[model samples]
Target chain A: MKQDGLTIPGLLVASLVGLILVAALLDGRGAHATPGEERLFLPDAKYLKPMLIGFHGVAADLLWIRTVQYVGTHVETDRKFPQLAKALNLATSLDPHFLEPYRFGGLYLLYLARQPQAAVSLLEKGAAANPGRWELPHDLGRYYYLEAHDYARSREWWERAATLPGRPDYLPRFVARLYAETDHRETALELWSEIYRTAQNDSVRSLALQEIERLKAGSSEGPLGL
Target chain B: MTVAAIALNTFREAVRDRILYAILIFALVMLAGSTILVTISVGGEVKIIKDLGLACISIFGTLIAIFLGIGLVSKEIERRTLYTIITKPIHRYQFILGKYLGLVLTLLVNVAVMALGLLGLAYLWEGVSSVRLFLAVLFIFLELMLVTALALLFSAFSSPTLSAIFTLSLFVAGHLSGDLRLFAARFGGAVTKLSAETLYFLLPNLSRLNFKDQAVHGFGVDGGSMGLSFLYAIFHIAALVLAAMAIFERRDFK
Candidate 1:
């Protein structure tokens, strides 16, 4: 009840009033438009590693979460990334054994950032560091098969990945179809059908069915019967 | 006989302190909470859980070591009980060592409890016993022991507040000593480089004891390094405890 500046309740009310006044003033001036994807100023991990006091794993995790958010922001905004590759490199360097940065970060680079070589390089680094992991090599195989269109490289990566435990059964099927089909359209159809057969959920199955139908349509002289 | 008696006494006193239980409970809670944090991670569930658990154990262990350790001597003096203890026929070095051992015993129990919790959680997460996590926890326990000795040495000669500050400063410096050497070599002249190297050699190179990255990453931590780290910790802790004993022996309880 007493209006003393040093008292707890007095200070609370004063702070609340001060905050409201600031907000009212800012509101009168109008809210500023959200800036374009802000700059990502990432220090080199070599220098940053020492400062983290051996907690670089969590630091890398937090940076990865931020990097994911960064990709999302760019995806929804200008669709241009000036710093994603650097962010991935730094995050991976901060904790080389963190597989997500290598696996999903590589995916983001390949598809979202549209830096195919950078994506390949990130996955290569991951595969080299984590030789036992299948995902990196598997993705590299997928990239070679789908994007690079290099059947030989895809088969090579897929072969190595298939040997590692936990690799999906789809790998050898991919390799078999790679060798069996001379026609690109037929290869695409078979790949989609395998994906449909092994699809984990309805959405994936639907996507695969669409791809199968589209490939069928592309190669078909008539729609009802080939 | 004297050291064991005093050590057991000191351990009993430390075990009774509320702060020890508080820190222990908080650490367990943090370990459990790591599961929730990992839900947002697209992958690395086991990793996030392991890393956070290890970090929680290391940090809370350090807090207990510092908070409880700085009071190991000064609190006795403050309560006017030091005069009674020193008046006994026991050598002051034995008392100091007893206190150090007691705190270390406390730390060992705390670290062990936390380590088991982490291993069980990790097992449930991945269904395999992570011996590597235990290795990391062992090194962390060694690090905490060294820190407790540092706190004892500081508390022997300084107030608890100053002891806490000095011990914490040394902990940070120890962790950064390797980086200091690197930075000095990269950016400094001959004198600076020499000074940095000397300090690096002088300070406890805690990174030498670090196998967390290796363990969590599935990197092979050789028995040689583990043995070396064990010896390194013993040497640092012995030196700190001896120095604290010497200082404590010279101090006038009156």
Candidate 2:
């Protein structure tokens, strides 16, 4: 009746119950994951945007990291990301000027996830917000060329990028190829030839040569497989 | 001369606070922890590091200012030294000003330490330490000065707990004033809109002092904006400090 501590038996029982509860929670979480649970139920950026007291850049960076992890998680298990666009949208809305999410995240949607329209929209959003920067525009041009195969739109984006400061020197060549009304096969060959010319490593140079030789042989396929 | 003496003494006392060291250690750890977080990110490693680092400095520096600043007056009163000090040759306004200055000095040293840590991390990650980051820190310092003044104003007449609540609330409100104005203008009714607009203009508008985005991206911050932020902070701090002095002037210390 006095102030004696809990006996070893009591602690052991408590620990057993605690471990079982944790296991139950884990099991429930895994079993009950619907589309709603895919993104961990984080609210839209509009609701959470004002609460941070103007730490939008930091918020955007953290959200972008989460987006990458979300993509990675889907890549491993089901390869079905129902909330990929939502995740990307949340990060971009928090910081419209953040280009990495727009750039690499767009590539993920296009090449990896095969969601072409989402990729184009995201890249266009980035380009619209950051017209002064060429990365988004350049990536847009590449996406249109590789996946969409819309030469006119691709050339327009490439020209915009080429005019912007800090664009890669090869961007003008891409624009030129588009302007000459060359077909996708010839343009693809020229692109690889340029890569072969400027290859810094033996492996990259070899890859470029293979791509170029494949194109030159008039294979019906395109470069940079989707 | 007397204010300077009080300010130096206050600075010495504030430096010994254990809470300051705790906050400083947490900030340094976060700055270093960002490196670990960057390993998984596919791009913007340098930008992520810089953004997190600057956010750490701003958030922690404001905590330091508010936490230390709130106690500047109450601690002396609690220690029963206020009576002894006020009876001396210094006026109450000078006392308030000196206390504010001392905390500002403390924030300067703390912010500079955190700034150097952030710049060092950014350099290690990116191979180039941008001097423009300091421009962000400069604006953060101005924000801290305004927060300190708010804390001092509340501490002049209220308990430390209430003072912290008031100061922190105003700090958040100041940052959100712009958004509040937008929401009010777009959605609110006639009277509600008018009141929100008035409060928005009357508040400190701390978001104006935010330059972290400019630092992370580029030097989009021009000279005109910096000058405007500085002038805004000066006016707000002056008004808050004067209010604190008036409250202290009429404070009836039993």
Candidate 3:
């Protein structure tokens, strides 16, 4: 009887330790994996809205964070952001007043994803949804000026951005310069250089470098390049 | 005096429930996990933490309210404890009110603990305490009280299983009532519009009681609206509790 009691206790302890080790190994495997590889499929915002049960803002916040992770993971390997725009779209749709996803998502779509048209559409939606905010219109203007090379649209957006409250001081100056149409190549070079200097990732830096090089070669080719 | 005694006893009973502690522990764990969640967000880390933390408290707190509230009367009846209580020198309405108060009190304690954990986490993140976050939590507590009243109303008339289902349906419907109103205005034709409008007015407008968006964004919530929401919650809760009392008074004990 004494030996049997000791045997039971020993078996219980061994099983407990064995279970903990297995759990730790599983946890370590999950922790070591890249966050991007674990993509979450979110349902449509219309269907999701009612199910959120008044936690829509919290859901939006989580989706926005997931979009950031998607960008961080894909920006390195595939240089493809298939889900980034969709995630941002869903997040903003759930909470239309959320401003960050529109601004930053627009930048990522434009520069890294090379979806300039989609970027413009997203920024336009953001501008309409958030009329009082200056950042959306300001970003729209920047995309037009730098990427699309559509000076007329850029000037129009910049003028609108300038009229809004909290716009940076440089916006009005850019609007004026765009209207004057003076030193276009120099301005493009300066914008690309700034983006290159402030870029947080290798993809953005390389894109900026390519733009700078293109601008430099064009400038060397004189007014015909402009 | 009798009602107070029953209320206190019910509160003690609720405190000892293992499910309450289980939900409370899960809520606290999720609130603590907000710290890890914030590290992944590029900007608005503080907002993410506060938003998720408040959501965890509200969601888990509602589950506790519904689960416990539904069992308040039925569990007593099932254990033959209701006979002893009804045979006492107490009215059935008093018993119902006592049960409701006890659950509300229990919810108050749990929500306060969760709120403090969230606020402590928020302070650690941004180094400042937010009055708006607290106000949001207060409204969430009121919402939970309303849900508890709902559970009690169903419990007085039905089985605990059915009561849980009814309370949860109402919770979903209450939150969606605003959208229902909008749908009526936009798409419904004559009879459907009238029916939708009538249901909208009859149902609880939970969206009015939700201050999470205003709290997270630091937007100024108008004082008049806040007062109106508080009054709405009070009137709705009172109506539900009175209805429960009326049903309990007519319920067959034999």
Q: What are the chain A TM-scores for all the models, listed individually?
A: 0.76, 0.72, 0.77
- Model 2, position B109, has a per-residue lDDT of 94
- Candidate 1, residues B84-103, lDDT tens digits: the string is 88889999998998889888
The per-prediction CA RMSD against the true structure, in angstroms, equals 5.0, 4.3, 4.5
Scored by TM-score, the top model is: 2
1 or 2, which is superior by TM-score?
2
| Alpha-carbon runs more than 4 Å astray in model 3 | A1-42, A179-226, B182-195
Docking class of 3: medium
Q: Per-prediction TM-score, please?
A: 0.83, 0.88, 0.84
DockQ of 1: 0.41
Clashing pairs in 1: none
Error of 1 at A169 (Å): 4.6
Fnat of candidate 1 is 0.57
Model 2: lDDT to the true structure: 0.85
lDDT of 2 by residue, A1-226 (tens): 3334557668889999999999999998888775325654457788888898889888889888888888777765777767777778778988898888987787678655768889889989889989899988887887677657788988999899999999888788778878887667766776667657854435446756876787778775554454
A-chain TM-score in candidate 1?
0.76
Whole-model lDDT per candidate? 0.83, 0.85, 0.87
Query: CA lDDT of A124 in candidate 3?
Result: 93
Find the number of clashing residue pairs for candidate 1.
0
In terms of lDDT, the best-performing candidate is 3
